[model samples]
Target: MSQKRLLLWVFHSFTLIAGIQFLQYYIFYNSSYPFPYTANLVNSFGTFYTYLLLLPLVFYSAKSAFSNLENRVQRMLLLVLSGLLVSMLHLFVMHFVNWLQIYQWTEDPFWNSYRFLISKWLHFELIAYFLFVLAWRFLVFEKKGSEASKPEYWTQIKVKEAGLVSFVPVEEIRWIEAYDNYIKVRTKKDKFHLVRMPLREIEAKLDSGHFKRIHRSTIVAIREVVAIHQDNGQYRVLLEDNSTLKLSRTFKKSIEDSIRV
Candidate 1:
């Protein structure tokens, strides 16, 4: 993640924990409970601290499991295991905190108090873990949708030729050819423009779905392709303007995959 995004995630996580804890405190304060306000506040803060400490682990495990595991069944199994582990860790911490409180307030044995605490809170802890997993899945879904909706092409490009500089619509470009240290851009209107930039640099800016580099020195717009033919062990791309360009064997499969009949 970028630094800005990391900071945003941290800020949001902290805000969510603090908001939830405050709400818990308010509810407890207004209710007719036997517990003192200090106990309620301490318990709320403990819950907040447990989740805050587990956030990084939860995020990393979810990301790694989804990205590294290709099998759907395996990915799901890993996610479930991670959730259970986190929940168990939370339970342990909560028990430890409760043990400390009991030791300070009463003379009850640590094991007896810990067992009672686990029996009371285990079900709720599991519910929280499930929610955490669901939240991570939602975040992944949102990120994927955001990426899919982004624009895939440049609207226009600036070109200079013959002491004149002008902006050309990217859709009008038919093909590009590498010329020494510069590139030559050809348009559907039979206009030729020269720009003092490397072919690789221009290729990076072009949308992969709309244009493809067929050779080290040539990039063609997919919409301008008329036909692809193989002759004498050589591949050729026929363009809309009755022009044919050699297709490198290295890129033949990619071109074939990108174009549909």
Candidate 2:
């Protein structure tokens, strides 16, 4: 997994407990029935604790579902199975907690509380599982759709706010300069931002005909180059607009070969 994805998972897990607590409070405070404070609190804590205990289960399930499978149908099956497993785990924990409560305190001898808790468990687990699956689909797989289609206009263009829109057409954007979080597109317009996609993902979608990596931080458009000249130990690509694009030696041979052909 990439660093960003790892960080996102950590954030999601951390916030999940707080979200469950908030939801529990909302339900209790807004309810018509006399709130069973102790019982509801116990159930909420159980939900939180169970989810924590099942962290590894969910992670491994999601990982296995999405990993090393070239076949789309097989991957989808694994994903469905993983989601089912998570929901089942949630249900089991809810029932197990109800059994404990029944054995501990007979003051409130009502099965409705157990049923309500189980419903909550099902609701939260299903939503979380669905989110997990959707997140994996978006991050792990590049779906084919209209977004991948090419536009007829090729030459002159303009981009909006540098941070909001990525003006670097996939074809014109050769490489990018990735900063702490943002990336600057080195397009025919020079280094500008027309999109906010991560550097790695953008690199994946770029057509090899027009762009490729020259450095960890740089990607250059092939058609933009007017000439490439050796500069000491490194290289420089002069574009048709007279702006220079850097070319590391690692990528020099490929660019040279492209130019030769």
Candidate 3:
């Protein structure tokens, strides 16, 4: 990760924990018989800062599990285990901090309040652990998707013809259609070639700016598209070559976004 991304990730982690802590503090402080304002603020934010100690553990474990575990069940098991370990470490740290800050103010020994603290915060701590995991997943996937959106599309498709292999400029191809197990790559001049490739695979290779899938088994060149006709909520795409193709209901929104009309 870059320095900028690292800082952004840290900011998100702190924001999540700080927001939760603020809400928790506000609720407790507004209740009847609340503790003194100074004590309440310090104790609440102290716990928030202590949570910072486990942020590294939470993010590192989540990242490791996502990278190493492909199975959903395995990932969940590893995350649960990591969450348990983080909670254990947090409990010890919180106990030590409590003792250090309140030894002069309270009579309760640190060891004596272990069970009380567990009862008060164990479930909530586990909840916070899961929240950190969710935050990591959201940030990581959004970054990956943002980068992948600007992919370099294929320029030329290899063509194997007769006993010799050739090349077809992607611009010359008018549309592609699925023909049984292979795809029929058709050109504007009415010539066609069959290739052992899936429609979806070829569609991914094409630039969305130049070609758009109008159906599950059909992709048309944007320049070849002349007009669209609609009737009874169904759509048909008319091409300049006098070929008309079904504009599937599922792909209607995709066409609208691509054509911007």
Candidate 4:
């Protein structure tokens, strides 16, 4: 994530909890609940701050425990394990922070709270982990939907590798080159995939305005082209990845025109 986005997320989360705390105080006071305002807000915000700090732990736990298991049952088990592990770690941190903050880092109080927190909020901690994960997944789905709605000159590509199939967004592809019996697609990230199609056939399907054939064997995403240079006596097309491909004399003008526009 970009630093700007991360900061925005943190600000949003802080405001959300602050708003909730105020609402909770208002409701409790009106309903004759006897909890003191400072105590209530302090505890909730303390938890919120600790949760913010431990968010990385949650992500790391999920990723480390995932194991890439394809089996549905195993995947579910790993997910639950991740949830449990993060919950436990969160519970630990909450106690540690409470000890440092409220208990003044006293040895006895820290040990006492640490020992009994599990019995008190084990289910609540696990539920919080699940809620965070569920919310993250929902945001990711919404993001994908938003990206899908955007106007794109080219559609996705179906790629099969390692006995598994996946779709690569066409906008991510930087260039393509003809390989015997197939075309090699190179993404902006420098990952390559051999697509089972002739260069001429695939070229027809591409958006002419976005992709320009530089050579009989190479076609580049026009937007990714950084510059064109004639080094020595040969024409070359420079791409965003800092690599160059041979530019056929016949297609040089076509690429220049497409990229210019």
lDDT (tens digit, per residue) of candidate 2 on 1-261? 542564467566756765678576767673653445555666666655666566556656666665567787997787677776778767777667766755345564446555665566666777877775566446543342234555443332245583553334465654566776666765544566644456676666656566666667777777766688877767888767777767888888887777766
Candidate 3 residue lDDT tens string, 1-261: 432475466667666776677667677654652455445555656666777767778888888787678899999999999998888678877677656656436777666687788878888889989987877767674465467778888898887878788778898999999998789999967999888788889999999888999998999888888878996778999888888888998887877776674
Top-scoring candidate (lDDT): 3
Q: How accurate is candidate 4 locally (lDDT)?
A: 0.76
- Cα error, residue 100 of model 3, in Å, equals 2.3
TM-score for each prediction?
0.53, 0.41, 0.53, 0.44
Candidates arranged by lDDT, highest first: 3, 1, 4, 2
lDDT of 1 at 31: 74
Q: Which regions of candidate 2 are displaced past 4 Å?
A: 1-36, 103-124, 136-261
Model 3 misplaced stretches (Cα beyond 4 Å):
1-42, 104-109, 139-152, 156-204, 207-220, 225-261
State, as a TM-score between 0 and 1, how close model 1 is to the true structure.
Answer: 0.53
What is candidate 1's lDDT per residue for 110-199, written digit by digit as tens? 777767767887778767666655666565644764787786667678987677889999899999999999898999899988888999
lDDT of 4 by residue, 1-261 (tens): 433464368658877977788677777673575545655565667666767766666655544444345577876687788777777777887777556555653556666777688888888888877666655445543464467776544598888988999988889989999999999999987899988999998888788878888999998999999999999999998887789999999999998888778
Give Cα-based local distance difference scores for all models. Answer: 0.78, 0.63, 0.79, 0.76
